[model samples]
Every structure is written in structure tokens, then in C-alpha cells.
Target: MDALITEAKNGDKEAFVRLIRMNKQSLYKTAWIYLRDEQDIADALQNTILSCYENIQRLREPKYFKTWLMRILINECKDILRQKNHAAELDDFAEGVHCEELNLCEWKQLLLCLDKESRKIVELYYFDEFSVKEISALLEMNSNTVSTKLSRARAKLKKVIRR
Candidate 1:
């Protein structure tokens, strides 16, 4: 893995492709969980890959490639969300397709009730199927903090769902 990363950093396209191929699923899943929209997930994954390729030279530790990639992915997602929020002020709905249904409405309402960080914790832990440790590392947070966030998020979700 270290050799592959070194080759990738040295402008080996094949090595870079291999690295992306190996982590594609995880990357896509992470994006999906965060964005909650297929197009957003796709865009975020592409951005992350491009950023990784462009900035591979900045990676000092080869063993931390996964962590670094995840950080980039998370940052991309956050940027997207920020842009979406800004656009929402001028538009009715941020670019996502919506269907008419009571359940869907309820789900959207439930999601809307969550604070951003809590929503992120819930999405990463439950929707992405990430372990608490993984979530902590990916979010650059302590495991105990992740656990607390998850608990609070779940409790909030339950309250919203019950109402």
C-alpha cells in the first residue's frame, strides 16, 4: 500500500487508479450517507478523487492515505452542504428531486429537525454503517464524542419520529 501510494504521488496514474478502485465503494458510501442524494454523492466522490490526485504530494504519511482521503471527502461534503444551504435561502428546495408522499414528507421533516452535526453523526453511524471508531477517525473526533453525538442524535430522531 505504501509503495502504491508512493507511486501515485510520483505521478503514476495506474497506481492512483488502483488506489481509487480499492476505496471507491467506501468513498461512495460515505458520500451517500452525508449527502443523502445520489447526484450529490456522485459529485462528492468525484471531487474527492480529483482532490486526492491533485494534492497527493501533500500526503506525508502513506499509511494515512485512507484517513486523508476520508478527510477530503468529508470536507467536500461539508462544502456542498454549505453551498446548498446558501442556495436554499434564494430557492425553495436545494436541487434534490422530491416525491409526493406522507412518509417522505415525514422523513424530510425528521431530517430537518436535526442540527447539522447530529445529522452527520446519525448518517455516518447508521446510514453509512460505520463503527463509532471509524466515525471518530473519519470526522477527526474522539470516539467518546462520537458515541455521545450518536446517542443524542438517536434520541432526537426518536422524538421526531414519535411526534
Candidate 2:
């Protein structure tokens, strides 16, 4: 991965493609936390790729590639959400029906009950395997806040499961 990042920074397109391919699943899942529309997800991904490609040289460290990529993707998702805020946000019932067709995993299905920010925090912790401290830094929250949210999200999940 470091080699790929180095190669990509040096203008090697194939290496860059390989790097993105390696992280495609993660990128989509991260985007999905903020976006329900497939088109929005695709748009965010396309924009992220373009931005990454253009700024690969600006990346300060190979080890931070995933973190950097995620930050860009998250920002793109936020931009899309902000742009679409004027539109009527889907209610829980509509969201459930819409998500049903997508056939998400049980965990992801439950995630829909969360607000987008909590959803992002939960997904970053569990799905992306980011530590609470890491998640706090990534999301610009305090570590205590991240831990509290994680605990509350878990409690919510537990309650949902009990129903």
C-alpha cells in the first residue's frame, strides 16, 4: 500500500487505480453512511477519486493515505448532504422501505435508526476499525464524546434488538 501511494504520488496511474480498488468497499460504505441515493454515492466517489488523483502529491505520509482519503470522502458526502438539505428528508418509515430494497446487513439495517452523525461515528468505529481516539480526530470530536456516542449507540442497538 505504501508502494502504491508512493507510485501514485509520482504520477503512476495504474498504482493509483490499484489503491482505489483496494479501498472501494470501504469508500462506498463510508459514503453510504451519509447518502442513501446510489447516484449520490457514485457522485461522491467520483469526486473523491478526482480530488485524490489531483492532490496525491500533497499527501504528507503514505501511512495516512486511508485517513486522508476518508476525510476527503466524508467532506464530499457532507457537501452533497448540505446541497440536498432543501429537499424533504426521508422519514424513518420511508427510509426503512427504501433500505429494505437495498438488502443491507442486519447491522447496517439497524444503523438507519441513527442520525447521520451517530451513524458515521458508529461505522467509523466498527466497520472501519478506527479506535475511539482515531475516530475523534477523524470526526473532529473529543475522545470522550466519541466514546460516549459509541456507548449510546450500542445501547440503542441493544434496545432495538430486544424489540
Candidate 3:
């Protein structure tokens, strides 16, 4: 995978495409958590792919490719959300296809209760299994800030679950 990333960074289009394919499911899952409409998710993924390809050379660490790609996807999702000026309701999201790994209603409801940033932090930390430091780099946040947000999000979820 590191070799593929290095090749992609060095102008190998096929390697880049392979890299994208390898992480497509994770990309879609992250996008789905943020955007409700499938078309919106598709558009964001496409834009992220293009942005990543264009900026791959700037990436210093090949091992961070997944997180870097996720950061781009998150930014693209935020751009779409800003353009739309509204978030889709939980019902809209519930009607859509689910991620096989996280199809639980309780978990979905808990996630939906938090604001976007908090929800993203929670998802990336818990679902994607990214460490706080990794998440901070991916989200361009301070590590302490990521830890604080994770703590707050967990507190919020606990409160909601206890109700």
C-alpha cells in the first residue's frame, strides 16, 4: 500500500485509482455520516478523489493516505453542506442505505443527536478507530482539542443513552 501511495504521488494514475478503490468503502461510510443524499455523497467523493489526486504530492507520509483522503472528503462534505445551508433530517438519513458495519438504530440516533463536528469526531474515533492524534491531524485540530471533543461527545452520548 505504501508503494502504491508512493507511485500515485509520483504520477502513476493507475496506482492512484487503485488507492482510491482500496479505500472507497471507508470514504463512502464517512461521507454517508455527514451527507444524507446519495447524490451529494457521490459528488463529494468525486471531488475528494480529484482533490486528492491533485494534491497527493504534497502529502509527506504515505502511511497517512487514508486519513488524508478522509480529510479531503470531510472538507468536500462541509462545502456541500455550506452550499445547501441545511442539514437533512434523521428520517432522510434513516431511509437511505446503511453501512453494514454500523446498522444499529441506537447508535445512529446517538450520533444524530450531536452537532456535525462532534458527530464527526465521534465517528472517526470510535468507528474508524483513529487515535486522537491521528484525528487531530486529519481534522486539522489540536490534539488536546480532539481529546476534549471526544470526551464531550462521549458524555453527551452517555447522557442520551441513560435517558
Best by lDDT: 3
CA displacement after TM-score superposition, residue 134 of candidate 2 (Å): 3.9
Badly placed stretches (over 4 Å) of model 2 are: 86-116, 159-163
Which window of ten consecutive residues has the lowest lDDT sum in model 2? 88-97
How well is each residue in 1-163 modelled by candidate 2, as lDDT tens digits? 8988999999999999999999887788777666768899899999999999999999998998988998899899889988988532322221222233434466557777877667777767766677887677678889999999899988998898789
Candidate 1 structure lDDT: 0.77
TM-score of each: 0.64, 0.76, 0.78
Please state the error at residue 70 of candidate 2 in Å: 0.9
lDDT of each: 0.77, 0.79, 0.82
Q: State the displacement of the C-alpha of residue 47, model 2, in Å, after optimal TM-score superposition.
A: 0.5
Candidate 2 vs 3: which has more TM-score: 3
Q: What is the lDDT of residue 12 in candidate 3?
A: 95
lDDT digits (tens) for residues 11-89 of candidate 1: 9999999999998767876676567677887889989999999999999999889878988998998899898884211
RMSD of 3: 3.7
What's the CA RMSD for each of the models? 5.9, 4.9, 3.7
Model 3, span 1-163: residue lDDT tens: 9999999999999999999999887788778877878899999999999999999999999988988888899899989999999873432232343465556675776687787778778777766667998889888999999999899989988898788
TM-score between candidate 3 and the true structure:
0.78
